[model samples]
Target chain A: MKVRVEVMLKDGVLDPQGEAVRHALGTMGFAGVESVRQGKLIEMDVAEGTTDAEVKAMCERLLANTVIESYRIEM
Target chain B: MKVRVEVMLKDGVLDPQGEAVRHALGTMGFAGVESVRQGKLIEMDVAEGTTDAEVKAMCERLLANTVIESYRIEM
Candidate 1:
C-alpha cells in the first residue's frame, strides 16, 4: 500500500526556510505573497496490509518531530 | 484564499536527502521500509478569488522548477 505523510512545523514555530522562499518570491516579482508555510511530504510504499497503527507508530517514532512538528498520515 | 502547492522532483532525479533519511530510519531499526520520496508543501494565503491562471503562474515562476520538478495546486 502507498502511504502519504505530511509533516509541518507547528504554529508559532520559526521557519527560516519558508521565510527565505517568501523573500525570494518577492524578489522574483511575485507580489502579494502574504504568508507562506513550508512542510515535507514523505511517500512510502509500505508492505501490503500494513495496519494504521503500524503506520502511526512509524510516524510517531521516525517520521516526525512530535515536539515542534505535527504529522498527518493518509493511506 | 488558502492555497496549497506540492512540489516534487521529477522521476529519475536523485534525491540524496531522501536517501539519507531512509538510511537513518534503517539505523533506527525501522525495517521493511522500501522506497521513499521526499517533496515540499507550500501553503499560502493569497488574495481572495485568485485565478487558477495566477496560481499556475506562481508555480511556474516561483514555487517549482519546471525542468526538474512538478507541482500541483489546490485551493
Candidate 2:
C-alpha cells in the first residue's frame, strides 16, 4: 500500500522557514504573497497488510511532533 | 487565493533524509516500511488575481531546484 502523510505546523505557531520564503518572494518582486506556511510530505510504501492504525502510530511516534504539528494521512 | 506547492526529489535522485527516516523507523520497531520519500509542501495565500503562470515562475525560479527536484502546483 502507498500512504502519504502531510505534517504541518499547528495554527498560531511561528514558522521561520515559511517567513523566509515569503520574504524572498517579496524581494524577487512577486508581490501580493500574503502568507506562507511550509510543511512536510512523506510518501511511504508499506506491506500490503499494514493497517491504518499502524501508519497512524508511525506518525505519532516519529513522523510528527504532536505538540506543535498535526498530520493527515492519505491512503 | 490559496496555492499549494509540492516539491519532491526526482526519481533516481538519492534522498538521504528519507533513508534516515526509514532507518529510524526500523530501530523503533515499525517493520514493513518498504520505502519512504520525503518532500516539501509550501502553502501560500496570494492575491486573488495571481495567475498560474506567475506561480509556475515562482517554482521555477526559487521554490524548486529544477535540476534535481520537481514541483506541482495546486490552486
lDDT of every model, 2 decimals: 0.86, 0.96
Off by over 4 Å in 2: none
Candidate 1 C-alpha error for residue A25, in Å: 2.4
Q: Candidate 2, what DockQ?
A: 0.94
For model 1 the local lDDT of residue B17 reads 78
Q: Check candidate 1 and list the clashing pairs.
A: none
Candidate 1 residue spans exceeding 4 A from truth? none
True contacts kept of each: 0.79, 0.90
Model 2, A1-75: lDDT tens per residue?
899999999999999999999999999999999999999999999999889899999999999999999999999
**Top TM-score hit:** 2
Error of 1 at B35 (Å): 0.4
Candidate 2: Cα lDDT at A21: 97
For candidate 2, the TM-score of chain A alone versus the native chain A is 0.98
Candidate 2 CAPRI-style tier: high
Which candidate ranks first by DockQ, i.e. highest? 2
How good is the docking of model 1, as DockQ?
A: 0.75
